[model samples]
Target: MNSKVVEEIKIKGGRVLTLVEGDITERNVDGIVNPANSYLQHGGGVAGTIVRKGGRIIQEESDKIGFVQVGSSAITSSGILPCKAIIHTVGPRMGEGYEDEKLSKAINSCLELGLRKGFKSMSIPAISSGIFGFPKDRCAKILVNETISFLKNLENSSTGIKLVEFCILGKDTLQAFQYEFEKSKPQS
Candidate 1:
């Protein structure tokens, strides 16, 4: 609960994109994106933390969904978590062919799913960057860029999402995302 707001930026349509150093399970957003395996098991890493804090109903709901393809996402109840919903996204592992594109698609899938679900705010982690072994810098860049692009495109469209947050746990990962976010700022 000691999460710090590392950075906040106003994107298109005045929507806010924030980077936070904390636990995603504790975020009080409309939705939280989980970096899940295809089976949707909340057994380890971020998934485990979510299941532990959110409760077993998350895995139960995911079991009902069965499987999600890499680069795709599925929605489920947030269980006991503060969020309204959990977006379980399957990101590609490093060394897989087309890792970059798959990671981008995974991010887009989470955002689009949240938008479709009429969520006004959502928090996401650095998908595939942990045990999946994707490079931190590349993951940060892809996630930030994709999120900014999605928000920009949503400006003219009807969407309930107004705030997107990158909730990172580790100090190094937070710094990487913060750097990417700052580098992505529009020059005046």
Candidate 2:
């Protein structure tokens, strides 16, 4: 619960994008994205943390939904967590043929799903930067760029998403995302 917003910026449609350093599980958003595998296994990494804090209902719901494809996402109840829902997204492995594109698509999938689900705010972590073996810096850049592009294109659109937060955990991971967020600022 020690999460803190490192920085924030406004995108199109007056939406807010934030770089946060803390645990996603404690975020008080409408939804929190889980960087899951193809099988929706809640064994380790972010997925495990979500399950550990959120509860077994999350995994049970995931089992019912079965497998989710890479670059795609599935939704489930947040169990006892603060969020209403958890968006489980599958990011491609490091050796995958098209890692960058797949990661971008994964982020898009999470955002699109959140929009459709009427999520006004959501928190996401570095999708493929953990055990999936993706480079943290590249993952941060792609996540920030793709999310900004998607939000910018939603001008005048019927989008309910007003806030998108990158709730990173580790010091190194947080620094990576922070760097990307700062670099994204427009020149004064």
Candidate 3:
């Protein structure tokens, strides 16, 4: 769970968007978005780590909720974690038809849920970029662009979201996200 903010930028409406390298479970944002399966299993990957750090109650609550459709999201208590809630989102697996659109919807779903919950800050990971076999570069691009689109459209002046941190893991994933964010920066 070792963590640090590698880069940050002030987007439209003065929202502080950051690219963080570390475990999502350690972030102290208002909510942490988990890239989960449709059945909400927390047996491995980031989902497992979240349950391990946050507590089994996270999985128990997810089990209670049953299933979440792809490109959708469901909220659960953060358990022992610092965040107020855990937004579980289902991203598309590789080879799935319309993977790009589904991933976009999944990211958007997390943001919309976070907005509705009045979360001022949220930590999200590279959805479906792990065992699901999504190309990290593409996932990073989608994650960064979708978040920017949401913030610019809503404008933090009238929204509760003041910060959005991509709490990424692994060197490759971090690099990919960082590169995408760098590309998004406005020229001085």
Candidate 4:
């Protein structure tokens, strides 16, 4: 429950939220967010990794949400991904209007949902930049900004989330998040 200012940061990212190349099931964040399709079923991408590692229970729980429109959110158990919970978020597809803003909204909403549900740490991937189509750099910047914004606004949020990390998997995705994170770090 350390106090953190709602201020901008200048970061040198030696790490980031793992993306396509990172191991999704090995993370131990209080919760991990998933960029899921409306159906929540696993497929040939990040979603697939989740299902493969976490198990069918992940998709089954997600099915309870029905169909979450793009930019909206839901939450469920991680099944078997090593994370305690999974925040299922649906983001805008490529060329969707206001995609970046919607992506930020989706990302923040997922975190907010996790926090409200009593999680103290959250791990999120680069939203909307993969199959959804938003540019990786743009999504990373907005994702970090929106995450910071939410942290700043949450009352008594200190212990609520001591660590909010991005889990990037691919080299390009990793570089994108790291670059934006470093750019956003507060100058010492």
Candidate 5:
């Protein structure tokens, strides 16, 4: 599968946010965010792909961490994958109350985890937009907004994060993210 970078923008603090049409498991970054279940299972979707490529050690570590609350995140070794670690975040399933808030919190949780780990870069998928059933357009807006908010709020001491890529799989989703990103870009 060819990974196409649809858009890239420089945000505050010299960090770059990119929208890429690709598999998140294939990204070469300091960490990759997995749109995971609260139980941290690696059975399907992006979770399955990450486990298959990064090896069983990722699952093994997840087994130890056990359950994560919706909107919270956990970290695990990435095994043989290109990235150093995988950040697993639990997002709300549709029909659940407060889906928007939960989705925003999930994205923020991933960014907070990356910053705390002092990671230089990370890649994230559209959390909750898959089996969790979050609307793609809403997901794009929440993800991009939360990411930009996080970057803008960062202190000089938390400057390690320099790049964030939204690695989307489908064309529609990629366009959704790209459009939101473009709208959110700082006006020169």
Candidate 6:
């Protein structure tokens, strides 16, 4: 409802900033991205959630990718979601230890692709931090920096994303992001 890029989707019995879950499409953004694995076939993790809520097409199109390697971003029509498009990004798994650069590239590349595909708005989950195993605090800090950097570059542009939201999954993750945004210092 608020055209605000960052919003607090309040819910009862939760931390003030904890319930930051809202429909990415309701933001009326050009797109919302999923931090998906290479398979595109939704199994569990954020991919599972997006697949369940966003629609089956999320999996269908993702499956079409065959095997998306890490650090690359891809685009697909929102077969069932309200948003105009879906950007699936393959973030590096944590076990390999390339979190920083790979995560950065994934986020940056997703935005770049969104812009290139003619999208003016986008919503994203915290990439690599959940199932991908990126440390929550560190990932939150990096994500905040990356988003602010993206906004700084898009200061006065139309194709640039006017709204860049971090659709966190739970209270702890939400708090981490809030800490990062408020103090410019991520919570450990």
Per-model lDDT: 0.92, 0.93, 0.92, 0.72, 0.91, 0.70
Per-residue C-alpha lDDT of model 2 across residues 1-188, encoded as one tens digit per residue: 69888989788678889998888999889999999999999999999999999999999999999999999999999999999999999999999789999999999999999999999999999999999999999999999999898788777876678899999989898899889989998677
What RMSD, rounded to one decimal, does every model reach? 1.0, 1.0, 1.0, 6.0, 1.3, 6.8
Q: What lDDT, from 0 to 1, does candidate 3 have? A: 0.92
Q: Tell me the TM-score of model 4.
A: 0.84
- Which 10 residues in a row give candidate 1 its minimum summed lDDT? 152-161
State the displacement of the C-alpha of residue 13, model 6, in Å, after optimal TM-score superposition: 37
Off by over 4 Å in 6: 1-19, 23-27, 156-158, 185-188
Model 2: lDDT of residue 102: 97
Instruction: Report the C-alpha lDDT of model 1 over 74-117, residue by residue, as the tens digit.
Output: 99999989999999999999897999999999999999999889
Candidate 5 or 3, higher TM-score: 3
Which structure among the candidates has the greatest lDDT?
Answer: 2
Query: TM-score for every candidate vs. truth?
Result: 0.97, 0.97, 0.97, 0.84, 0.96, 0.80
Regions of model 5 farther than 4 Å from truth: 155-158
**Per-residue error (Å), model 1, residue 102:** 0.3
For model 6, where is the 10-residue window of minimal lDDT? 10-19
**lDDT (Cα, tens digit) per residue for candidate 3, span 1-188:** 57989988788787878999988888888999999999999899999999999999999999999989999999999999989999999999999889999999999999999999999999999999998999999999998998988888877366679899999879999999889989998789
